[model samples]
Target: MTLLRRLIRLLCGTDPVLRRMLKYWAATCVLYVACIGMLLVQVELGLSNPAAANGLIAFGGCGAFAFYLLIRANARLKLEPDQLAVAQAVFSLVCAFWAYAISGPLRAAMLIMAVVIIVFCMFALRPRQTLVLSAVAIAGMGATMWWLQAHDPVRFPPATEALTFGYLAGALLSTALLSGEMSKLRSRLKRQKRELTEALETIRLLATVDELTSLVNRRHMNEVLKAEERRQAAGADTCIALLDIDFFKQVNDQHGHAVGDSVLRCFAAAARASLREGDVLARWGGEEFLLLLPDAAPGDARAVLERMAERVHAMLVPGLDGRRISFSAGLATRRAGEPFADAISRADKALYQAKESGRARIVLA
Candidate 1:
């Protein structure tokens, strides 16, 4: 079973585009098989010359094999899907015309083959392209039938040829019309699918992200903290820090909330740049942020918070003229089997102690 699975993967490959190309390619190859079958039956019934049937069969086999290799190798990366569909339609029509020209009694099968071609093409081509393909098939076959009636009137009678063409014309035109309507329906469904995906993404961002600083929101942070607490209980090192920007209310009260918002944005940007790749920061509340450091020792997590505090102290808030930004942080390394709420409460008390100890410093809990 594993060997069979490996062989299927080798032939079909893992590329989605290549698989789609091969699907249509395989359908066209099936039509080639039908053509060869018709030729063999015609020769057996003595309705076609054996010499002519042999040559046409060879041509059909070569065409199918060559096209299979082209589609399997380069067509997926190079050819537009509609262009490939049109090419396949043209090839199928050419082979059908060749087979019809040689067969005497079983020529009606060629009309069925043409109908199959148009119906298969509906999956890939537009209405206009299908219409064009239908017209070409009807005209080319009609011309071939008329020419054969003139040259071999004993085998292909004028009355029989005319009636067959009338049936062919109606079937192809009606199929073309229905294919166009279905193509339109398919386009509308694709558009609706794209719109639905975009709307879901917007809703997700609104639920989890803060609008002002574009950081993760408080509720989502709580979820992340609880997950980290569980990992800590399982022997993973996790740390939490409560960060509060110092003297932020005065910036809002004196310079207006617009400047305060700008300052918050600047602080978020600086704090983001200071953290390692695995660390997460979220807006805990107005003028307060939360930081999560997973898989870190107590001393290392404290050093990370101290570095973040230094970055806040050295940076300039955009609307503050030449004034610097400062923040106070309280760091707590999670103890085994402790709930995040208890850790947050201890960090909050440490934040108060930092405020009392002249601010702009980090206090370890």
Candidate 2:
């Protein structure tokens, strides 16, 4: 199963349409092999026209080889599903012609194959194309029947021939109409599925991400803290820090809320840049943020927060006219078996201490 998946991925990439077309192609190949096998059985039983049977076998062999080449070149061709369907329809027409020429009594059965081809087209082609292809199949059959009447007038009398053509035409038209309705429904369902998936993704982003800073929001951060607490209880090193921009309200008071927003965005960017790969940064609330550092000791947590503060200071907030953007942070390493809220309360106290001590500093709890 794994190998089959890899093969499909290699041949079709991640395109759902291509994967579906590949399956259709496989089914068609199987159908061709079955037809060839049936022809051989007919020959063995001495119940077939040797010349006609050989012609079909040769045609089927060539068709199979061509289909193999088409599959092999799928990557380079990059054919759309509609294009493949049209090709299959054309192939089916040719097969119908050959079958009609060979199967004297079974000629009507060959017309069913053309109906099947028209049905296949309805899945990938528009309703108009489906109708047009059905017309083409009807025309091909009509022309073949005309030629047969000209060559073997006794075998295909005028009345019987007219009735046969009428029946075949009615069958093809009916199949085309039914298949066309199915095609429209399939397309509608596909469009709805795509829209639904996009809506879900948008909802997910709105729930978990901050609108202004693009950082994970407080809700997601709380979930992460809970998970980290569980891991810490299992003897893992997990440290968290509460970060608050120093005198952020002053920025909004002096420069306007827009500049204050810019500062928050700048601080988020700087902190993100300073943190290592596994660190999780989230907007805790307002001008405050939380940083989760997994597998970090107290010293390591302090170092990471310190570097973040340095980056914010050096990268001065936009519209602040060279005024350094600083923050006060409180670091708390989770103790084994301790609740997350207790750790956060301790960090909050340390944050208060850092703010009371004239701000722009990191205090460890």
Candidate 3:
């Protein structure tokens, strides 16, 4: 048993592709064996020449095995399955032609085997490939029929071979047409699937992003705060801030809503640049932004807001006429087990106080 297992492994490699090839070859070998048996039966019944039939069997059996072994030995080739099928079609056709020529009175039955090859190609080959293969089969069989009529008229009569060619042509051509139609359906479905995926991604972006400032919107920010609140429950320190642009309504009134929008966009860019890694910023509502600093100390959070204010002061939006911008912030640290909304409420009160005292400073809560 051990020796037999080793021999099987030696013949069929352990790769997934190799194992699959073994199964394919097993099915093909069964067909070859059946054909060999058919040839031997014809010879025993005196319907075919024993020597000629035996030679064709020997050639077919050896040729098919050689192709199988070649594919197995180069399992890493990763050959396209259609290309492999095409190779098998060519090999099978050559054997069928030989068997037809020598099978004598039973020559027409070989067309059935050719039909099987055409059906396999219908499933395996693309529309254009199927067309090319059909052309080759038609041409090869036509040439064979012409030769047999000229040299062996007694066995391959002109009228009979003519009828057989017509049957072969109609069968192959119709199957190829159906295969092409199936290919078009598959391609259209694949294209629609790709388009659906892209549409879903666009919808997700619109759901979570503020279209004006390009920051995370209030809804998504609330989700982030909930996540951070859970972290705070486990002894992690997080700070929350609510910052408002100073005199934003006046900017909109004086310079128009366009200039106000530019200022907001500019402030958002500066604030993002000033924040450290692991900081989350969002557009909470008009002119107001929320900031979350995870795993941070109160002092560190203060420094981050101060740095952001400095950057904001340096920014000049379009239509500002060289005037600079600044913002006021209310900062608060989350206590262990405190809810995120409570922390945000405290920050909002501090923000109102900062605006009353001065517009460009941060007030701690």
Candidate 4:
């Protein structure tokens, strides 16, 4: 299994369209080999003309190998979609010419193969290109019939020649129209899928992120806290710090709500810069935020919050002249298997102690 996966990775890489095309080409090669084998068996059993059967087998085997190599080369080159479509159309025409030459009694059946090729091209080529390729295919089939009739007039009578051409034309037209419609539907579905994916991503961001400060919202923070508590229950250390801006009400009263909002945004940005990668900062409420420090005890968590406090104190709000920002923080480490409510309550109590003791200090519980 590992070897197979490695081989596929080496061949197809990460492009889904390339992988699908590879699978299609692989299937086609397998079908070609099977048909060649059957033709050889018929020649051995004296059920087919030895000379004609040998020639057809040799031609088919070489053609299939050449086609496979061409596809592989194109895959390696990473050709654009338009170029690949043209290459495939040319290959299909060549195969149709071969089929027409050797068809004998099954001449009409070979036209079906040509129709299938044109229909397949609809997915990758525009309708106009598909129509053009269809015309080329019809021309190739007509030329093949003319050559065959010239060589052996008894087989392709002049009377049936008109009927054969008419059938090929009608088949190509109908298949092109139907396949063109299907191609349009496929394109519409692809566009809708892309739009839906983008919309889902936006909704997910709005649900979990605070719009104003770009921090995780309180609701999402609670979910994170619960998850951390579960990790704590498994003997991992985690701590939570509740932060409140000092005299934030005065900033709103004196400066205006817009200025207050700017202050909050600046503070949030500074706090994020000061914290470690594993720490999570979330907007708790108006002028309040929560920081979750995973794999940290109360002492380490307090040190982190103290650094953040110093950073926040140094931030300069534009409309506040030179007044500095300050925040009071309370840190509480979760005990093994302790409930989330109990830990938050302890942090709340410590926060109240810090507010009472001094406005710009951290209290650890």
Candidate 5:
């Protein structure tokens, strides 16, 4: 049980693609062994020359193992499709020649396999490369057939012209139609994958952002602050600024929550526009907003906060009762080696101080 646990962990440590390949190969090997066993039964029961039949079975078993190795190598190394296509085509042509020496029906089957190779090459390799490879394979097969006939004119007469014509015609027609369809499907699959990835990203963004204010929501902001703390621990300078709308509770009480909500959105838009592009802004909760500034020293952060407070104070948005709206702010820097929660507590304390002193000023802690 301990050994099995270790093996499971070891396998889980690999990339997802490789793990799938390993499972697939293991299943395929089991099926292959079962198939070989069935073939052995047929050899024993039906074949007159058991030795020759066994030899043929061994040859096929060796070829099957070789093909498995090729697939495993491509999966393990993540070889490009073009490389695999060339290797597959060469293997098919070689098998075709070997089958031609074995029997007529076997040769015909191998030719069909060669056509399948052409389809794969057309889909997997560049168009020009596929064309060159197809031409070479055809020429090689023709030359080999002609040489065999020439060497044994009496024993191996030229294949009937009609049969030869039929084979070539069938191979060419199948390759053209199947290869074209496969290429189209490949292109469609790529487009669908791209669209799915884009949709997933859009969903993730929506989940993290507040729709009304277009700022990071409370949950996302908490995550962001924690991540920023980790960065600070790695020697990054960091600061946090908190902002609160002055008399926000009174506005909602006097006007309506609807108008208060509009004011909140407007303030958020203004703040987002005024801050530097690098600043991270979030709706901390209620009427409070938080700004996380990576690489900002205490002085620089305070200066930015003061500017933002001035902007908020000067802005005139109609409140619930058509009055002006404004806000106060607090700024704090993360002390060297300080915990993230402590920095937030310090900033919250400074925010309360700003509220106590007056409603429209910036205080640094």
Candidate 6:
């Protein structure tokens, strides 16, 4: 059984819905083929007339088509809540009626098949839909049996009548319990899937963001730079500015790494505040950050970086013993047909000029 399960998993992809639909249709196809094969064998044994045997084969063929349609429908349709509800209801009715139609061991087999369908529907359908389907199955089956007994007597014997009624009662009871349990299971699975997806996204974001400054990290900065290059290459004007905390090592020595981190966070906050909507900011490296300013010229880039640097120099970092943080910025506009790396290198060189002249100033390269 475990080997068969693994084989099925290998044949199907990891998507739960696609896997289920594929398994359902595959199993249905195998079942119909087996039924046809059995009927053909029975005909060969002379246990049934050729006409009845052919008719059974024809019916099974028709059922095979219906299952094919079901498979096609599953693939083609984008099953919304209302559509799934309708499909569940229809399947439930079909199962119940199919159970009441067969006889003897075949009748028992149909009853079990009905239970299996109900269980699958219960798990796949929403709770409200499952409840409605369960009620529909029980009521429809019971009413059908009552009508058949009243309308015909020769079709069923005393023992058959008793067995049919017992089967109906048992199917109803089993389906109701199964529906309840499966509803809870479905809810739990959905909740767990949602939580798992959210956790994965949170981890992905943490991997991309700097924990100290909450800015895009160096890894994500590379991605952003690539994207910015593409955007600028498409005829959009852009600039790259490199900002470095002035005398950051001295600050860490005078204060502490905790206060240094606080200063970095404070600088990031001010930089973000000065940025326009389309500008991108990231922690390029330790005490160094990069900003990709879209649709900006050299003068605009210098003005924004200068204002940001002044803002960082004025703000008192609470954890830095009320000391203010200062930074130097190098502003460079995108040269026509220039690579992003070249532009960044020019801005980095200008930043060195800012520190060379004096700390806490902006230099345009």
User: Candidate 2: where are CA atoms >4 Å away?
Assistant: 1-22, 33-48, 74-84, 126-129, 177-181
Clashes of each: 0, 0, 0, 0, 0, 0
Name every residue pair that clashes in candidate 5: none
**Candidate 1 residue runs with Cα over 4 Å from true position:** 1-16, 45-49, 72-79
Candidate 6, 205-252: lDDT as tens digits? 898999888888888888887886776675346889898998899889
Q: lDDT tens digits, residues 1-365, model 4?
A: 69999998886666787677677667666756765675566566665577776776676667666655665676577777666666766766776676566656655666777887787677778877888888888888888778877888898775576688889989998877777788789989999999999999999989899999999998998898787766667535788888999999999999999999999999999999999878999999999998889988777888899899889988888999899999998888877777767777888888899999987999987
Candidate 3 residue 310 Cα shift, in angstroms, is: 2.3
Tens-digit lDDT string for candidate 5 (1-365): 59987887574445675455455445534644664464456555652245644555576567656655665566567776466557656755665554454443234444655565576567557655666667666766676667767776554467652365357556755565566676778889999999999999888888899888989987888888777777667535788888898999987887789888888888887788677767888998889998887888888877777677666655666654446667777778888788767777888888899999987877888
Candidate 5 stretches with Cα past 4 Å from truth are 1-121, 124-159, 234-237, 249-262, 276-278, 295-298, 314-323
**lDDT of candidate 1 over 104-198, digit per residue (tens):** 67788778888988898998899999999999999999998999999988888999999999999999999999999999899999999999999
TM per model?
A: 0.88, 0.85, 0.76, 0.88, 0.53, 0.61
> What TM-score does candidate 5 get on C-alpha atoms?
0.53
The ten-residue window of minimal lDDT in model 4 covers 39-48
- Model 6 scores worst on lDDT over the 10 consecutive residues at 98-107
User: Which is better, 3 or 4, measured by TM-score?
Assistant: 4
What candidate 3 gets wrong by more than 4 Å, as runs, is 1-92, 95-126, 148-158
Worst 10 residues of 2 by lDDT: 227-236
Alpha-carbon local distance difference test for all models? 0.86, 0.82, 0.87, 0.80, 0.69, 0.72
| lDDT of model 4, residue 22 | 71
Clashes of 5: 0
lDDT tens digits, residues 14-93, model 2?
86755666678777878777777766776677656888899878877787668656765777898766776787778868
State the lDDT at 44 in candidate 1: 88
List candidate 6 stretches off by more than 4 Å.
1-157, 174-185, 234-236
Order the candidate numbers by TM-score, best to worst.
1, 4, 2, 3, 6, 5
CA shift of 253, model 6, Å: 2.4
